[model samples]
Target: MSDHTIRAEAPGDEAAIYNLIAQAFAPMPFADGDEQELVNRLRADGDLALSLVAVDAGGVIVGHVGFSPATIDHAACGWFQMAPVSVCPPRQLQGIGSALIEAGLRHLREQGASGVAVVGNPAYYERFGFTVIDGLAPASEHDQPYFRAQAFDRSAPAGTLRYAPAFG
Candidate 1:
């Protein structure tokens, strides 16, 4: 069994987190190298809701997950958007991703977030209670099961899920 713990990311973890994210997501689709840009923008914009990491027993960062601010028009609803979730290549499928996601969602709930959105696999995210928002358009054309949402508290917003400009 892998010895791992999930916790909020720290300032000291910047380098490790960057390296882990680059290595883990180097093969995926979507904007490449934009992960770091998104992270930087979120931090600079003061919109990061939660930045979490999973570390092994030896203190190696193996996974990272981030929840940033998402909004829809005039409503001041707190929307959590999950992206750039990365798990070390060797650590993939060992539950690190799931753990990070769960921990991040829990943290968002405790922080009083109204809802959370994700642009990811529905099959995988469904385990965390995510569901398709009927009648809700995605922020982009890419929105589908991959761009889904789940209400950590009450129901999710019924309109489009507008991600931050950094996502553009």
Candidate 2:
């Protein structure tokens, strides 16, 4: 709800984005503590399909959301994975994260992306239209409960969805 602008990640934004993500996830019980590195790896491998950052009125980076190409059944299916959505500790719970996610999804829709998948809290992500597809699922069984998706076009594809290599 703060006065912030959501925009694509720009040059020199990496460091700030990195710190922001790290700080955001550090307190989460389920965080793997490698999210920051994952973002770096995604960028390094050119697998970052989309990365958006939220800058507050003071020009401070407060939130970020990343999207990467994901394959369905071992083949590109025009689908993407949304991950590592982060909001600075002090800026969180204020709708900044949701705003970042909406902006990223909007951009992907505009680019004609087939759909997007996410692994997270069902109650939270479901608000964005993400749902568990009967046949579509994530690679890891442990992620089954958290996996949710949204298709931009027609019905969601049914198959095993794999995240980018960096997710390994």
Candidate 3:
């Protein structure tokens, strides 16, 4: 059945959140296996702008996503970065990740964020309005167009992007 619910992560879902992230990234050969720990660091450092989860009809957390503050040319107030989005391996391809992203973006818009950036599969993120613009790229190794942004307002800043220190 296709009836999972997308909701903000609660204070007590730490273990489940970590497991979901671990499970989702296990198949990626390039994964360094530190994504969940990064989430913890983000939470500990107060950089997590938002954290959301997709709970199946059976009340199991099957997907998750996080947004954190990022900067462009030293400006830190308006832009955010979406990262470490994950869904349980069994839950992939069921729209759970998409729902998490859509809900997170809606929440960010409601919070008045000016933009969101992500480094991900180009074909997948393009559906969410993320596009490569000049002068914006992640500090990570990947330099492809998958480093993209979706501007909430009409203007998108042009400069190097620095994700939160927690990403280190």
Candidate 4:
């Protein structure tokens, strides 16, 4: 396995990040043909809590992950929603995605975030301590079992998870 470093994203990394996301989710059924738009919207809104990228020794981007503000409609609560986690198709299963996620989550926790949510593969995300949250809804009404969450602090709030307007 080649060594890859995961770090906070830089300004010039947008195009590479977009391309990685586009390639990773290209065949998914739920995209509705606007993956690039979603990426752009997230970037433009400045709602991202943490945007991370995995790079090779030479600094070539191989994966990307983003977390933005999420709410649970409860008190003393501020959570992050993980979205658009993408690993270059050729780099899948090489721990790049894991690095991005772990690094991003650590950053969020350091920033005092209470929790984090994710709409992704159940089996895969569960490895990162995420679990299905009943009665919690993604910003949309989409019925997906992969819509899950995890609290960094055990005392984090609980309720229906709400994402930003970009998800609508």
Quick one: best TM-score, which candidate?
Answer: 2
Q: Mark the 10 consecutive residues where model 4 has the least summed lDDT.
A: 135-144
lDDT string, candidate 1, 11-105, tens digits: 88877887887887787776477786677677678876689989899988889998888876635588878887899899998889988888888
Best by lDDT: 2
Task: Tell me each candidate's TM-score.
Answer: 0.90, 0.98, 0.94, 0.88
lDDT per residue as tens, model 4, 52-161: 88898888888888887877764326788888888878889888888788888878888888888888778899999888756556645564666888777757454677
The superposed Cα distance between candidate 4 and the true structure at residue 29, in angstroms, equals 4.0
TM-score of 2: 0.98
TM-score quality measure for candidate 4: 0.88
In model 4, the Cα lDDT at residue 164 comes to 67
lDDT of 2 at 146: 93
lDDT of 1 at 27: 77
lDDT of 1 at 12: 87
Query: So what's the TM-score on candidate 3?
Result: 0.94
Model 1 TM-score, 2 decimals:
0.90
Pairwise TM-score winner, candidates 1 and 2: 2
lDDT score at residue 14, model 1, on the 0-100 scale: 78
The lDDT of model 4 is 0.78
